[model samples]
Target: MSQTLDLSSAPAILFLFGLSGSGKSYVGNLIGELTGCYVYHADDDITDEMILALQEKRPFTNEMRDRYFPIITEKILHLRQHHNFLVVTQAVYKQRHREYLCKNIPNMEMIFIDASDAVISQRLTTRNGGITGASALALRRDFEQPDSNIKVILNEGDKSMLVTQLNNYFSSAQPEKD
Candidate 1:
């Protein structure tokens, strides 16, 4: 059977939770194409200074996350006033941060795109200047697995196959038509 996403069934705001290189951006882009929801990448809008810091081999600090959260929050709120969204961010590692978003965004839901540590490590090597294995391990350690309000937990698989599976999942999760 062909899998399809029922946009109406989708939450107004959806956050994809995963470590870096877990295909959040790729899947988000697919969702954007299949659905008209605007997909925003928090890192893409980082300040130049942050970019420079990254160039200097300094990873994003907690202070930077605090700074970006409000900015991205405001942008999401503004855009949400006009459109639905699929926001991709690495912020879900923090419970309090995720709570803030849950409280602020209406009809929001979290989706955890999970994969094994080995898989994440392998995928990292394919990207330019990807996260170090140690960093990935750190994220793994600091990761607070969410317990509630999760719409779905998708496992990492073949990109194309995963997309189709997600499409079907989203479609099937819809409430029945009247």
Candidate 2:
């Protein structure tokens, strides 16, 4: 049997914005589990060339970012049409990309998940067994803290607690799906 796509059931998205070691994926997963939303990590769309560059200890070049960013955004836009609520984890470092998301998506809310540099370093070290320490450091250096707009900042708490808090917040904040 063929299934029809129901765009009306799709809820608004919560964009998880953060640096590499800032726990976007972990928190997004937890939030998804807690709130029944699907989570998509932008890293999952990393190109083969970008993966090879990172594996070879080369910089994540601008050309790679320019090439892959639109692809990622397109995936998010497509996902928004299908999922009720989607938690998208991405390092939206570029202002233009942020602008595009803000302009295109309806009821899109940005949530900036951040931690201290020391905490991020610890997480990165633990995550990769310290193999990519240099790249982690470079990512930290290149990280840009997004500005406060209509966005939520989550930093001071454990993931479970924060996830619960976010779940509660969105429960009341997000509009009911049709």
Candidate 3:
């Protein structure tokens, strides 16, 4: 179950959606490396315009997520045409995202990296330079992971196990012959 995917036409989009400090970015990168696919992070604002827009919007809401999800969806679809496959990470906790992606995408799989609130808080607090009670509370409240077509990796103290599980999940997602 550890073979590379043959993605010649359009690269399948595997959206890694999980809570903050849940290692979506890190895991996405690792998966990309293992599968030889490019890892795309939608959160980065390379362009100044997008930054200004996000800033003006202020505190992120479900409403903003609703409006912004489409832009990335379209982008991923467009990117698949050129590359063999793409691995993207997003922080989707709402039900609509799960529904929309499953409906529209030809081959899409959502992997929810499950981690405890304590783990997430610890990771954030250590890495964010500084952490606040408010941010921790926000994460607890807002990390709404959709449970459709999801493969959960038990994110405990075992790093190797998590990686193995992720690799297996990708292998399963790729088409198999009888």
Candidate 4:
């Protein structure tokens, strides 16, 4: 069944992902602000306690899709009922998780903010000065490059220009297909 949403109330979730400092959070927030959607970043929301619990008790795996994705899915579905859109920034590196979100999120769209590894490394250092190289290494190792369905944007060192392009790309208006 095709689901419909009230554009004035909510659009759909825009899942943003990329390496550290590739502008996922920056663009997610700007898209939410300009698009009138709620922004949800896992780095901002998932508490340390919860992460520890996941690590200590049982590891999260692809098999855990019904388990974890459901929690996220249920929450977003709840918000989708009331908001105009939900913008989520999380590192979903695997094709499977991407598929899970694609299948579950009703009308999901993805944006992969791409930057050269050097550019990301430089930006991350400037943005998160306290982060260790190990952390950046993990990010580099884990981030999966987006496939054809994802919209790609190169940083090229211009924040204002990127923001303007994004404002137009992520219009508050609904898609014609919807």
Most lDDT-accurate candidate: 2
Best by TM-score: 2
Q: What lDDT would each prediction earn against the true structure? A: 0.66, 0.69, 0.65, 0.63
lDDT for each residue of candidate 2 in 1-178, tens digit (9 for 90 to 100) = 1222222322488788876677787777876765577899888888998778767766666677778877887898899789877888887766666777777777777777777778777777788442276765655565565765645645556655574456445544455769
Q: How well does candidate 1 score on lDDT at residue 107?
A: 82
Per-residue alpha-carbon lDDT of candidate 4 for residues 38-63, written as tens digits (9 for 90 to 100)? 88876544445445534454333444
Q: Each candidate's TM vs. the true structure?
A: 0.76, 0.78, 0.73, 0.70
Clashing pairs in 3: 11-84, 11-85, 93-144
lDDT of 2: 0.69
The TM-score between candidate 4 and the true structure equals: 0.70
Candidate 1's residue-wise lDDT over 1-178, tens digit each? Answer: 2455565556777788777667677677777876666887766676676666555655556676667677777777887787745555543566667777778777877777777767777887776764555555555565677776565545576555765656555664654669
RMSD of candidate 2 to the true fold? 7.2
**Ten residues in a row with the worst lDDT in model 3?**
2-11
Q: Per-residue lDDT for 32 in model 1?
A: 80
Candidate 1 vs 2: which has more TM-score: 2
For candidate 1, report its TM-score: 0.76
Please report, as a residue range, the 10-residue window in candidate 2 with the lowest summed lDDT: 1-10
As a TM-score, model 3 comes out at 0.73
Per-residue lDDT of 1-178 in model 3, one digit per residue for the tens?
A: 3444433433377777777677788777866766688788877622344345334533356666667777777777787787767888866767687778767766877778768878877777777432244544554576565665577765765556665575555444555768
